[model samples]
Target: MKIGLYFGTFNPIHIGHLIIANHLAEYSDLDQVWMVVTPHNPHKQKHTLLDDYQRLHMVHLATEEYGKIKPSDIEFKLPQPNYTVNTLVHLKEKFPANEFALIMGEDNINSLHKWKNYEYIIENHDVYVYPRLKSGNIDPQFVNHSKIHWVDAPVIELSSTFIRESIKNKKNIIPMLPAKVWEYVEHNLFYRK
Candidate 1:
């Protein structure tokens, strides 16, 4: 099986995240796409993040209806400030029979050099890069090579920061998030003041 790992904090999985994962599952060559809900993102701020379990549950709610897009909690057991390289290595060991690919946005592709052991990641994994809204064609050196694919997934501009801010400000977030996710947020009062 060819599995595409879509890594993210998914602070609260929004439509944009879902769309990218769905594209990888249905449109790309990937057999399935798993949204790897990270406990912490090394490159990002951690102060405002929801608890890892909550974030994982939110991802589950957001993707429940999508059979092709599954939610993963593999990072929860991994060390803090999880690095993509380490997770890929661990997953490869655990699921030896399955071929794994990396799923990321074009914006992430632009910052590929900054990631931990990014060279190894590029060399070993088949990467499916989706487009980000307002982002022009970003061609990194690694993308010029084979195995790294630039996917034409639609650009959905929504961000978790915007979703959290909207929730904190008591703005309607139903349009930005899935119905189950929005309901879970409202019921749990996540990201509220």
Candidate 2:
């Protein structure tokens, strides 16, 4: 099986994320897309994040309806300050029969070179990139790399940060999140600081 790993904080999984993951699962050569919830991203601030399991639950609620997209807590058990290369290596060992790939946005591709052991990641796995409105220069070395696959998925401008702030400000942001996720968030009074 060919699995595409889509890593995110998923502070609260929303419609835009679903669209991109589902699109990749349905349109790309990848057999399934795993929504790998990161426990803590080195690049992101830790204080703003919801608890790891809480975020994972939101991902579960968001992706439960899609057969091709499933939630994963693979990173939860892994050592923190999580690195993509390490996860890939661990996954390859655990699922020896499957071919693992990465699903990311254009913006992530732009910063790929700065990631730890990025060269190994590029050499060993295929990267499926979805469209993003953010513009930045991609590393020249990856410009025409065969390992990277540009997927013409829809350009979604929505973001989790926006949703969080909207909720905090008492704005109705229900439409941005999956129904179950919204219900969970609302019931828990999340982000309503």
Candidate 3:
């Protein structure tokens, strides 16, 4: 199977994430889009994030109805502070028959060169980039790279941080999240500081 790995913290999976992943699964050649729930990196701020399993559960809730999109907890089992290159290598080993690609925003393309062993990733895997509202100039080298494919998907401007803060401030973030996921968050009283 051809799979596109869409990595995110998914603090609480929301509609924006579903839109992009669904788009890739339906419009692109990828057979399925895996919403790889990223584990919290000890190097980053932890106060804002929910627990790893909590986030993964939300992802599962958001994607449960989508046949082409699935939730993944692969990163949770891998070592922390892990790079994408390492994850790619690990996935290749674990699922040798499947062809794995990357799903990322246009802004990430600008910083792709800085990733560890980025050359290996670019050379081995296809990168499916969707548009972002505030993406800066992309690196000239990747502008026309064969491994990179620019997908004309919707530019979703929503964010998990915005939803979290809205909930904390007593705003209705219901429309921003999937029904089941929003219900889960409400029942658990998450982000309602």
Clashes of each: 0, 0, 0
Q: Is 2 or 3 the stronger prediction by lDDT?
A: 3
Model 2 clashing-pair count: 0
Q: What is the C-alpha lDDT profile of model 3 across 20-138, one tens digit per residue?
A: 99999999999999999899988898798999999999998898899999999998889888899989999999999999999999988999999999999999999999999999888
Worst 10 residues of 1 by lDDT: 134-143
Q: Tell me how candidate 1 scores on lDDT.
A: 0.86
Comparison by TM-score, 2 against 3, better one? 3
lDDT comparing candidate 2 with the true structure: 0.91
In model 2, which regions exceed 4 Å deviation? 41-45
Q: Estimated TM-score per prediction?
A: 0.92, 0.95, 0.98
In candidate 1, which residue ranges exceed 4 Å CA deviation? 41-45, 136-140
Residue 64 error, candidate 2, Å: 1.0
Model 1 Cα shift for residue 120 (angstroms): 1.5
Model number with the top TM-score: 3
- Candidates by TM-score, descending order: 3, 2, 1
Q: What digit string (tens of lDDT, one per residue) describes model 2 on residues 14-99?
A: 89999999999999999999999988665676676899899999998888889999999999889877788989999999999999
Residue 112 CA displacement from its true place in model 2, Å: 0.7
Instruction: Return the top candidate by lDDT.
Output: 3
